[model samples]
Target: MTDLIACTRAEFARLRRWPAFWIILGTWIVLNLVFAYLFNYLAYATGSSMRMSNGQPRAILLQQMLPAAVPEVFTQGMAMFGGALMLVLGALVTGSGYGWGTWKTVFTQGPSRARVAGGTVLALAVVVVALVLTAFVVDTGVAAIIGTVQHQSLALPGAGRSLLGILTGAVILGMWTLAGAVIGVLARGPALAVGLGLVWVLVVENLLRGVASIFAPIRAITDHLPGTAAGSLAGAMRTISGEPTPGVLDILSRPASFVVLAVYIVVFAVAMMWLLHRRDMA
Candidate 1:
């Protein structure tokens, strides 16, 4: 445990100086800002309305546009773009150690292979959580400003519910990051790990999900895929804004999705540990 903590601290210190980490984080913030503004602008122009349960007409444009609509915005952004970016970030962070021969040096320095791997994962988790919270803060600030300017209500989802949704999104992204780290360790390079991870996320997952729609049998299997399960987890957040929920499919219930995501994380972590222990890192 002492060695693991030391390694984790070292990883954190290294990441603090890593430009890619900041670049990705900055990009995420900027993208969220742009989208928040765009969505608000659309709401202002086209305008939207819906009937409340009490049969009263409600203006949904502000609800959909403002940061007060965080559940909707957070889940949509994370599930769609943020998740993919995290996978790449994870791959790069882990694969860089091997690319630069740092892994070899670290292994030779006397730490157990498991401790080294655990340290990397711990660092990645910390970074991921910080990034996720930063995103939430930035988006919320942007939305609040917009709402103030437009004289719109800044009503938000229940605190407990919103926090739970954020937590779920974080877990999903964390899993993606770990999976990418595993690929990095196995591939021993960022390029292949990132390329393969992107293909799996963008092409393979989409293709399988689409096919599942036409064929029932395939759907059953594809629904359990990591990406699919992640989407389900994110979708569990209720969007009171009445906007259409993002994502192509959501077959699993929230509890079931959580279980599947947990399975993926455990499997990836175990695979990474196994590879680290058996592979000749020298």
Candidate 2:
């Protein structure tokens, strides 16, 4: 137990010291801010136009941005900003484990292989959870400020649903971070693992969806892809025209995709442990 705690402490300290961590966090914040600003502008413009048509007050403009602010925001924002950013995040978490000969030092700490891997997984999970939640909170707060300043009613009808979406979306992204860690440890070299991890999120997963589109039944297969599955958590849908639409309650209500996400985490964690056991630390 002491060793495990020590490992966790060390992992946490190492991550904090890395420049990549700050870079990824900075990018995530900037992307969200940009989306929030654009959406707010579009919402105000459309709402003002619609209100004039109906002789309603200009305050209706705030409502236009409401959808973008709520359940849809986190998922859409993450899907847009998170793809590359998440890969960068995943890379840093996993990369530090193996990059710069850090893995050797971790293993040499005299803890058993299981303890070492378990500690790393725990540490990564904690960090991912904190990051995703913090990002969502920031998004929500920013939108609230926008609505408030614009004199928009803070009481959007579906605020609870939107909040739930933000949370679930964060968890989904968090799961991917865990999976990335496992892949990183298994691949051993920080650079190769980080490269493959990025490819998995940005290319392979997306390409699978594209291929699935041409085949009729295969389109449903996107429900299994990491990105698509995770998107479901945020209640996001892609139109047949390849446009994004807000997902319905039916999509978000189902819990199966989250289960699959957990499976990914567990399987990779096990794989990481198995690989750690086989490798010689010295």
Best-fitting candidate, measured by TM-score?
1
User: In candidate 2, which residue ranges exceed 4 Å CA deviation?
Assistant: 42-61, 64-69, 156-163, 216-222, 236-253
TM-scores for candidates 1 onward, in order:
0.89, 0.77
Top lDDT hit: 1
The true-versus-predicted C-alpha distance at residue 98 of model 2, in Å, is 2.8
Candidate 1 structure quality by residue, lDDT tens digits, 16-132: 899998887788777766654554455455554322222212355556567656755666666656777888888898888889998889888869889988888888888877877
Model 1 whole-model lDDT (C-alpha atoms): 0.76
Q: How does residue 49 of candidate 1 score in lDDT?
A: 30
TM-score of 2: 0.77
Give the worst 10-residue stretch by lDDT in candidate 1. 49-58
Q: What is the C-alpha RMSD of each candidate to the true structure, in Å?
A: 4.2, 5.5
For each candidate, the alpha-carbon lDDT, in order, equals 0.76, 0.61
